[model samples]
Target: MSTTVTPTIKHTALSDFKEITKMRLSLSVVFSSVAGYFLGADTISLKIVLLLALGGYFMVGASNAFNQIIEKDLDALMHRTKNRPVASGRMTVNTAFLIACVFTILGIGILYSINAQTAMFGAISIFLYTSVYTPLKTKTPLSVFVGAIPGAIPFMLGWVAATDNFGIEPGTLFALQFFWQFPHFWAIGWFLFEDYKRGGFFMLPTGKQDKGTAVQIILYTVWTILVSIVPVFGVTGQLKLSIVAAIIVLSLGLVMLYYAIQLYKKMTEKAAKQLMLSSVLYITLIQIVYVIDKFIR
Candidate 1:
């Protein structure tokens, strides 16, 4: 006799969690956290590292989820974002909200297990990113500046989680990431200006893609390079970078600046895309350099 068997259906809700949180973006955030943790801890603990990664992912995921919820309408209007789960009707706003709440609470709890200061910073990051920066994106270009504060927090949050205090070391990490975001994001803004315009998002400080904006991008790129190399002087306390590492990092920065200048000279979509790609390479390489220098020094 053959017996009939039925397979249990997996709920779609599980899939929605991954989609809404932008798991890839959350992973990138966690990478920075892990890097900071390694740099801050003399002896790395796997448990602390795991906790930091989990807490960082939850906080960043919650922020991304809430961002999608608030920008659902605007997202629907942009080709790049039109298919987002919330914007595309794959998930309801109520479902997104619940997920965001759960992620935020879980993230804070995990960080609190590490340290109260880390938990506090994690909460602040979510609140600022979701409540202030996300809405401000449509209102003014300064929103990027507002967003940078929360965006830069993760790198330093790991330090605080490991050490349970805010000091010169974490401050340097924060400044480095904070300055880096301007060029990285403005390159993206330049390339996606039309799409952002369609969504009523003011990403460029000049409101239009012009020489002024390009010049600002170049200026920030220079500033990012300066701050990134400062650790070479051995003045940033625990955040010191060796001479060789500084040279390698500076070279990377100059290459990124070259792309930024190219974009500025042409002010075309293709050039902007190149600049954006270069910016990504710049941030990633510098972070890796910092990690390598920490171990080799």
Candidate 2:
């Protein structure tokens, strides 16, 4: 229940906190929210952007902290997670809880200062991740479906933060990310099947890297690409993309689809990893293209 490290290596303790927060993942999540902000913003303010980054990081960090706390013992059983702060006994569970509390309070408070709606969604994401998704991971493969709810919120949360309204525009942004998550997560689950099983977590839809799983990934990849290009046709509200931007976005989707199809054809860990990497690139570049096209138009 107590940390073994002496006070001489205080920096190590700080690093533990950063690890506990999953800083890289949290930062990446914030980037998506920021992209959403840019898409919806009429006039950008440095202050708001900074706040969105800070508040979003805090919310995601809080969620990660709580997740690590709950998964501490399970994490220790998995090679990839064995060295994490809580799992390795570098940080006491009480210390992690304290950090989670501080992050949660500051995160929601900052968003509340921005707008009540943003604060509400921020709270919802935290609640869903920690309470529902975390516990359900080991219990059912359906956890991915449940997890996608909170996962998709950050993208739309930014739009709501900017406009203070939750409507078709925000829903469209939510839908794009919602569908994209299926392939992205399934690819990781497919590649990391053994690691996740070691921790008693089965996240893949079919619970194995079989044709059923690969087919689902391809279908979702197609769904993700189609939803992304829909805005180009001006079918969705206020999310119109120029013809050139549409072409670029479609090309990116094709690259992602190519990888997904490869994964389906080979059903190999190597192909799954390739799909995972391409999904990361596809989501990030698509967001960038959208922002650039927004300004171009």
Candidate 3:
């Protein structure tokens, strides 16, 4: 009985840790950073890749843990977030805070080993996410815009880690992710409107799902597609894209745009969810396409 209970306790603790850190979200963030690193790297170094992955994960995890800590009360009010470790009382606030502190130290230390710029960006991402964006969630819809800053940093952070220089290459990577977030997040806001409201969060640009919000989603999707193809024009320095890759990316973007347009026409929760899912696929596929093109071109 004692042995069986010990394993159960350990499993529960691990599950709680994953919940507080938002494991899946943190991993996706790490993927973006590693993809950027590959694009910027002249010759892939396994050590750098490992560092970027671990450091990026730790940093994102720390940011999310802090976000949960601040939003514990708010999270408790939302059905979607109610089961989170802190929100559900599965973990103490002090324990969560300690985990965040350790992750912060480890993330920054690991990134500093890569380069100062990478570490600096990681630190800034944490600060902006926890101190600014998290707080603004309950206050304004514009928090999505502010949140995009840190959200976009990981992609560019990888390039900086590889090159140790910030330029049009990294800048373009940043712009790509930055613009992409608006439509992606707003679609989520549209579908989860009621849940967000339960938490006192105003995430949509129009503060309600309407034609105005749909138009903004369509507009941003267009902008995201445009930014994605700009590297094919050869203006982005080391970040050039082949025509074949650009066409593939354009096709993917158009597919996502189709979903965005559907949301506009239907203005239904189902359409909004489709747009949100498409946005996720768009970002992931484009990152894969871009990295593959860099190698083949």
Q: Across residues 1-297, which tens digit of lDDT does each residue of candidate 2 receive?
A: 997976553448778978999999999889999999888888997888888889999999999999999999999999889889999998999999999999999999988887999999999999999999999999999999989988998888888888888987788889889999999999999888999999999899999989999899999999998888888777778777888998998999999999999998999999999999999999899989988999988
User: Per-residue error at 224 for model 1, in Å?
Assistant: 0.4
What TM-score number comes out for model 1? Answer: 0.94
Tens digit of per-residue lDDT, candidate 1, span 1-297: 999999853537666677799898799889999888888888899999999999999999999999999999999999988878899898999989998999999999999999999999999999999999999999999999999999899888888987888998899899988988888888788888889999999999899889999999999999989988988887888888989999999999999999989988898989988888888778777888898889988
Clash count (model 3, backbone only): 0
| Location of the lowest summed lDDT over 10 successive residues in candidate 1 | 8-17
Clash list (residue pairs), candidate 3: none
Top-down TM-score ranking: 3, 2, 1
- Predicted model with the maximum TM-score: 3
Decide which is better by lDDT, 2 or 3.
3
Decide which is better by TM-score, 1 or 3.
3
Q: How many residue pairs clash (N, CA or C atoms closer than 3 angstroms) in each of the candidate models, in the order given?
A: 0, 0, 0
Q: Which sections of candidate 2 miss by over 4 Å?
A: 1-11
Q: What local distance difference test score does each model get? A: 0.90, 0.91, 0.95
How are the candidates ranked when ordered by lDDT, highest leading? 3, 2, 1
Where does model 1 exceed 4 Å of error? 1-15
